[model samples]
Target: MRPIPHPGRPGKLLRLLAEKYPTKEAVMSRLIYLQGQLVLPKGVEHFMSDLHGEYAAFYHILNNCSGVIREKVDYVFGARMSKEEKAEFCTLIYYPKEKIEQMTAARRATPAWYRENIARCLALARLMSWKYPASRLPGLIPARLRPVLVELLATRPEADAAQLAYQQRLLASIVQADAGAEFLEDFASLVKRLAVAEFHFVGDFFDRGGRPDAILDRVMALPEVDIEWGNHDVLWMGAALGSPACIATVVRNSLRYDNVDVLERGYGISLRPLVTFAQHLYPDEAPIRAAERAATILLFKVEGALIERNPDLGMANRRLLHCIDFRNVCAVLPSGRYELRKAYFPTIDEDAVDPYVLTLEEREILDGLVTSFTESPSLRRHVDFLYRKGSLYLVRNGNLLFHGCVPLTEDGAFCEITYDGKKYAGRAWLDFCDQMARAAYLYHEQEALDFMYFLWCGRLSPLSGREVRTFERTFLADKTTWEEPADPYYRLLDDEETCERVLKEFGLSPKKGHIINGHVPVKVKKGESPVKAGGRAIIIDGGFCKAYHEKTGISGFTLISNSRGLRLLAHQKIADVRTALADNGDIESVSETVELATIHTTVGDTDKGRAMQEEITDLYNLLLAYQNGVLKPQA
Candidate 1:
């Protein structure tokens, strides 16, 4: 048989064929087709003569075939498939020179089958050359599969991309694989490795969101996590107690759906378990028990869904859910009945003042304060030295780190007295300061009662410059009355005096050169401003649990001290405080300027008049829109 002519070039087609089909079977098939030894099987015409296959074989395969075959085949016969028996016999054996000469002359008359077969082989080789592992598939694969492959590879111990993809496809084909379980196990392992200093959960831990029991279970399972009591926790606990009012008022208000019986039953069943958990966690603290009781009551008042949405209510609820103390019980008079009453310091009997109850730290601080007073002559001098100028200053490194601020006397100074040759001044001069501090402490203990009073009435004013003098006169002359009536503005003073006294009593000063006080939330700015007094009094309590500002975020601070200097740190972002308020159904009527002014005057001096004015203006606009039906009331 005449040698086939190369389709394009001998070297190029051979190289193309070698690159396209490295495997023996693929190479042998292409070679046999090029030699014109392959025949289309009967009844497979559709598969064999498809346009795509024809295009691949003619344009791609023959065009890329060896040049020697092209030359020989073209010399013997033109490019065409053979239909005669002679052509089939020619494909089986080599032809002599006489036959080759004759075939070459005949090729000029009729095209040879081997030429077409070589072209088809070259086309097939070209198509196969472009095929990638992914492209070999008939249909388009999803884009997500690549990432899935990568992720699987990352998770496997020794699997690479190829192995991962293979295994993934194999696994996907299997029925009912435990993908979710595997993912959860991996996530749990990751969580175990992460170390967290503290976990501050912001409400919604129970009853509102689904699976409160599950959440509580997870929290209890983790031994190190300490939760700051939230309103929902309190409501659930209260509901368990079977207190109708607590359930109806607090718990009911927080429920998403109106299911009185279900809520009651849920609380009834949940209460014992919750209380048992609390007892296990905090056995020594009675506040936990009180909080549980309070929570049940709150649940009756508020619904879980509403409470979940309002974080402020949750926070306030948590803060107020303290254990029932005897002093709190005494303040209300009747121990069993819950009544709204103004907080006042209970009259402490001499027998109640147990010296043993005082911590060593407290005794030391008290001794220092007394000693400093005994050494100082002038009351003003003593106050300044104790708070501002003493060797152990009351304001530690300008932190204003007193237990509390002194109730300013009428003379614009703290109360002063000379007792046992010791100059006892400031809050220490009057027994009332102690009473006020105790009241504040009680308020801190039972936030709901305190807040209820604040809502209906108003916050007790801190001692002012005038009241300190009145208190001083009363203590000195042993009379409650003064020539000029004590200014009511003095009431706005926070328990700063008491805080100072306590700090002094406890021997806890600003040794590290800054102070963080919790008794009063003093608004401090680095520079003097019309809105705030300039000082180092960093108020951590921005009334987070009690009051909140829509414009500001959660009011908390972290004080980091170093040799470089002290830095006042605030949260990078503010939280939505309004949502919290609305959730608890504690929304209050917007007070007008006049009303705010009245409130301000009652609290302290009228220093906040301008601020109150702006607030009143906003309130007015809000109310006007509400009246005009522009804004709907938020649930």
Candidate 2:
């Protein structure tokens, strides 16, 4: 892999920048351009969470910028463009390829329409690009269209008619060459890229919805984004790393939701081994009604082994297979003896001692499944992207982003865990777990890989937070056994002191920093507020997964933080993306002001801004070194 050049490259910074900006004019011009960008408004930061494989909705939010684009369009065009025209423009910008094809098919290519819309897109791009540094604008534009875009943006509205005519003629030539549609498509993408400075995924990108792969495609291409790994995301990531426990969970959950298409089609993973194993083990048993009991029994044994291995994980009593009196067709539970919902388990192997162990055929199938998980190129690529750009939690620009809780004890204190003979809690514990997660993929040792299993469901895991009752939920006839306790962190959310302590532990100012997180949905339908800890913390996950839309009663929540203030936007439920687009209906969003700064925030307030300021200081030092004759000044 080659190392890519970024804004700040340490040690040889003077030499590196000297290559491109050898002339003093070039260096000084860039410094001036950057200095100018600093005073201008900060680019907006968009925060989204729990997309959960709803590709179309995710695409809508990314394309429309949660109605930010619409507002900008209204501001830019207003009464100059009619309502109908504004709809068409927004649709084209969001779905350029499809909209262009529709236009070309419906009406023959008209130079006037092409010319006008291209100008509209360029205008929006111009608005988005203003706050960006002038030096970086060229790189953001496509090579073939760069000069025209530059001309369009750089031309003053007060320019002479002759100069304006030249710009018009250039566009006419583009349309005459039949490249208008493709050009606008590229330009539209460029507009979307520049519209938001950074994209943040608060977590849970897989399961419950279709097409996580599509979402990953956009995520991978984004110029800047960060992810906080959600529990479900870790489940899939663990499977991709060949953890058998995770593999079982993924397969079972996918099957439970009838989402096998995600596995067989989206990821191209063959489930033949499992299919054959099921056949071989069950031997064509008649009536799935009777066979489901046997299937459930086998599943219990598998889940039981996982729970029994980690007894102190708070699920030791989840092992219920041994308590089953096969002869009597019942299982004993803490609540009392319960009658089996479905009996007749032919594959129980009652006389055998270790019922928790997988059969020979079952082992072979599991090995094959593990192979498929680890060997699938597509699955590995997406998980690799997650590993590259994600973490358990991130503290950025005075806000803390995490998918799950910090793992608190019953009494509302940090749950300490000993690793390498050292007790770790709070931020240090999270850092240690992150390292262990990475090592789980890099190293082949059983201990390393097994740690992925622990992090996925262990009671003390910040990612898992509570004991997972997989065995109890699948096998128990008692509904009481199905209850998995919520993490204490969930209940302590309104504690300002707790939230402040968390912020301080992460090295953020307790007063200024905020915890912006989501794992559990904010049940707005039930009157649960997302803002907690007396406004020190916020949960933005509002169930982007269609499966939860009914329960959550809203599409999801997004945060937009720009120069002026921080605002929270809530989206209404989406029926269908194609239908919504065809009707020219945007995801109707309502926003509430979370904070309005007395003074607009600037780039200097951001983490990247600090990095840039350091670079500016370094450049000044380089200038000094050149004057002192330690390094020669470039021409």
Whole-model lDDT values for every prediction:
0.29, 0.77
- Residue 510 lDDT in candidate 2: 87
Q: Pick the candidate with the highest lDDT.
A: 2
- Evaluated against the true structure, the overall lDDT of model 2 is 0.77
- Alpha-carbon deviation at 457 in model 1, angstroms: 12
- Candidate 1: global Cα-lDDT? 0.29
What alpha-carbon RMSD in Å does predicted model 1 have with respect to the real structure?
36.2
Per-prediction TM-score to the true structure, in the order listed? 0.23, 0.91
Off by over 4 Å in 2: 1-34, 279-317, 344-346, 419-421, 575-577, 632-635
lDDT by residue for model 1 (1-635), tens? 22233332224434444345544455344444333311211000000000111121112111111111222333344445343432322221221222333444667312333333222322222232221122322121123243432243234323488765655453443213423223222222222212111222222233322334423433343322322222233333322322222233433233322222223342222233333433544455464443343333332223222323333321222222122234544211121333322222122122453212333432343343333322333322212221121111122222333222333454445545443355655434434333322343234233232222221111122221122221122122223322433332233233344334334443444222223333333233332111111222333332222132232332333333222233333322221222212221111211111101112111111112234444333344333333444444333
